[model samples]
Target: MKKVFIILLFVAVSAFAANPDDLIGEKFIDVYGKDEKGKIVKLSDVAGKGKPVVVVYWAIGDVDTYKVLPEINKIGKKYKDKIILIAPLLSVSDDKEVKEAKKLLHFDFPVWLAGSDSIKAYSIEKVDVPYILFIDKDGTIRNIMVTARDLKKIEENIKNLIK
Candidate 1:
């Protein structure tokens, strides 16, 4: 019994130490929404396109996330040709809010007004502002970060995905 308990503990620790990338080899769930231009876009369209895609999930009220908007925008423009940046504003139910956000963010890439269906498709339950999804060219989600506090980590992930 003691040996079995030790083996179980080892197994648990091993599982915990497993890399996040190893867990998501399949294609990402398709998330659809209208961009600031009122044109529809789908994650499926960009995924597997031989370029990395960064999807930022944020809400108007998330102050921290809002603070990082400029940085995210910079990332988008800096890697425009190498990758795709998609910012999805959560909890926005109308076009008016999207307009306000668009004017405020001024992101060069697409700023999508993600409706309930888009949020549901991602299986997001809470308003974890600044939630980020790093997807590879193969349509696999390499990382899902719930906060934007550590920009270096995100940058590193982006570099890895592109490289």
Candidate 2:
């Protein structure tokens, strides 16, 4: 029994240690969501267009997630033509909620209503709010920021991928 317990502990630790770096260089999985006008949108449609993409996962009521919107907005504005920014609101289905969230957040980037498929695809089911994924122009995930609010570092990642 002790040996079995020790093996299980090792497995759990190994899984935990497999961090976001493991996902780097892997092709980003495509996700589908709805636009502000209830039109269906796919991640592939907007990304991989000869420009880097910044995907930010957020929710309406999550304060930490929405709190970073202003910073993200500034980044979006600064890199307006250089990068494509997508804000996917996880678990948010209603268009009314999306509109309200937009009004409250005041972000200029495109917002989408991300469903379970998107949440699961990104492996953020158990992660905290304000998760970010930086994908290069080739659609490969270059970096990931989980629950991190470092705007400068995020901007740096974007800058590195821009060219």
List per-prediction Cα lDDT, in the order shown. 0.76, 0.83
lDDT of 1 by residue, 21-100 (tens): 45466578787877777888788888878888898888886787768877888777777888888888786556787667
User: Cα RMSD (Å) per model?
Assistant: 6.2, 2.6
Which one is best on TM-score? 2
Give candidate 1's TM-score.
0.76
Put down candidate 2 lDDT per residue, 1-163, tens digits, no spaces: 9999999999998787545678888988899998888899998997777788999988778878777887889988998888999988886468777777877888878888887877667677544568888999989999889885888898898898887
Which regions of candidate 1 deviate over 4 angstroms? 1-23, 93-96
Would you estimate the TM-scores of all the predictions? 0.76, 0.86
Point to the candidate with the largest lDDT. Answer: 2
At residue 115, give the lDDT of candidate 1.
Answer: 68
For candidate 2, the lDDT comes to 0.83
